[model samples]
Target: MAAQGVFITFEGIDGSGKSTQARRLADHLRAIGRDVVLTREPGGSPGAEEIRRLVLEGDPDRWSAETEILLFTAARRDHLEKTIAPALAAGKAVICDRFADSTRLYQGITRGDLRGVVDQLHALMIGREPDLTFIIDMDPALGLARAKGRNGAEERFEDFGEALQQKMRAGFLDLAREFADRCVVVDGNRGIDAVAADVARLADGRLG
Candidate 1:
């Protein structure tokens, strides 16, 4: 059956304020009486949460690009079957902080071709596209600076240097173009309120 509820995803490079804006958008929807559920990929369901640790906490040398992609797919499958699908089935709008696009950007950077990875994810889990995806675009250098300023600690991926981050940023823009129909590229260089306003507008259109 076609889903009755809306599924929206937030995407961006690190420190693009996607999480914060996603929460704001969810809150706005709830205020208007829409059934909303806020969630995140790589760490939404119980099984996915466990996979999140394995993906993020391990030593950089411990995992190859393919291994990282596989782990992400596993987490996504768990999240879809256990959390996302169920919530949407119940007629609740699901706003996810990060989704399949992350893998396309990160894994794509690690392993040149991302089409195969995306195909694998689609095969493993039912191909479910977000009703709307807000891609908060920002300069890699500025975004990383914000990330570093907010948190002293760094994960395996976050520890990557500027060049790598630039590549990931490019990947995000590329994916946004590839999925233009489903994606909205939000300018994230402005203040949080400005960014949140764009997110609110997008959610309002979808939820209405």
Candidate 2:
């Protein structure tokens, strides 16, 4: 029988360095002789990647909270069907930069009070959750500044500005509390190496 694979996700307000940490952890796991498949939500599969551009590249007000919830769910369903599930079935550790938890916040809370809608759609279309999640915590202003510095096309969320990030930070913390068993919060205020080290250690405990 194939060894069981693990589903891991990194989440935070934009520019919390969760993506960097996710990459580091994937490298660490690979270096330790484990099979790892590093991916990201909203764009893991080709179909989802198309959706990613639609949702992430447009104006901040381009889509309402309800519409975005639908778009994200569609993307996530495609991602799971095309990428995440196949890798996990093959017994490869799947490391994702972001996942459903992002929708739970960005649309569920920050954009509007539609957690119920997001939850209902998630339960219907995407029924999976990460086995382990790292919530990189950081100051909203700092994170927004870092995100803006990237000057990337996927700046719709960043354009929402620091206030949205602040709400997102708090919402993520609340989510951590709600799902304490799988969610681990890491301070993102220090050096990348320091944060990566902590993530690797925690992941080791679970991946063992």
Candidate 3:
């Protein structure tokens, strides 16, 4: 709300097409001559990127929920200071691939009790939230199938398997409902073009 430009973030379980939609939305806005800065977490900023590698490219049990939350918050803080804040201050829309909502959901899944800690840390360290958060909603099974087809070294979280994915999907939907003010649930089961159109239109509406 303090930003001169809009802040938008894409959130969803893996393979829900959130990343693709984020890219398309950024492109759409830029084509219309909007100054847009497209970025992603946990490595949007240089320091954060280093933290991203440490957190992402390791065993599933690499870090405890508490530690993971700290790393994510640190990355987010750096991202905000180095990239997001500067872009918005310069009056450019900041479109992030994944943001705090992902942190809430993922950490929630890893350890239910830590949700409180995550929220507290977020408030203390990273106080800002996106102006609009697009939750690309989709079925867990299908998302898993789509995710499994992709190969990446950052497969630790993906290895949580279908059960955690389902829980994460539900958690995202619940967040959308809980934070209906800024969160919009976009149907991710549809074609990419259709989904992108909806996301772009919604974002454009906010740009007003």
Candidate 4:
């Protein structure tokens, strides 16, 4: 059967404010009477949330790129089975902070050329993509600063430092082009309200 709900995801380098934008979009949709579920990965469902700490709270080199791919794919599969699929089946809009696109870059190119492995695992396990994605583009250096300033436990990825963040920013832009039909590159260097406004406008158009 055709899916009855909308699946929207936000992607960007750490601290690009995609998370905030995702929340705003979900709240906006819900206020308008749409059933919305806001979630994130490598942790969405119960099992996935457990995996999130393992992947996100350790040292930067704690997990090899290959190992991270397997872990992330496992978490994604659980999230789909327990959260995303059910929400869509129930005709609710699902706004995800990050999805497979993140794995495709983080585990795909960061340590080495492992994107093919990530893709294969995804196809074998998760086998889905967001219907709409907002790739929040930002300056890598500034984004890294902002991310670290939060002093969050999930600073493992941020600890990879500016170089990795630069690579990630470029990788996200490339993915936006590669998936242009469903991806929108939003300038996240702007103020929060401005960025959120653009996001809401684009999302409303799509949801309409």
Tell me the number of clashing residue pairs for each predicted model: 0, 0, 0, 0
Looking at model 4, which ten-residue stretch has the lowest summed lDDT? Answer: 1-10
Model 1 residue runs over 4 Å out of place are 1-3, 152-154
RMSD to true structure for each model, in Å:
2.0, 1.2, 1.4, 1.2
Q: Give the alpha carbon lDDT tens digit for every residue of 77-193 in model 4.
A: 999999999999999999999999999999998779999999999899988888999999999999999999999899999998999999999999999999998999999999999
lDDT of 1 by residue, 2-107 (tens): 2477889999888788989999998888888888889997889999999888887756666777778888888888899999888989988899999888887777
After superposition, candidate 4 runs with Cα above 4 Å error: 1-3
Candidate 1, position 42, lDDT: 82
Candidate 4: residue 163 Cα off by (Å): 0.3
- Winner on TM-score between 1 and 3 is 3
> For candidate 2, lDDT tens digit of each residue in 118-175?
9999999989889999999999999999999999999999998889999999999999
CA lDDT of every candidate: 0.81, 0.93, 0.89, 0.93
Error of 2 at 200 (Å): 0.4
Q: Candidate 3, overall lDDT?
A: 0.89
User: Per-candidate TM vs. native?
Assistant: 0.92, 0.98, 0.96, 0.98
Query: Which residue pairs does candidate 3 place in steric collision?
Result: none
Q: Can you give the lDDT of residue 137 in candidate 2? A: 100
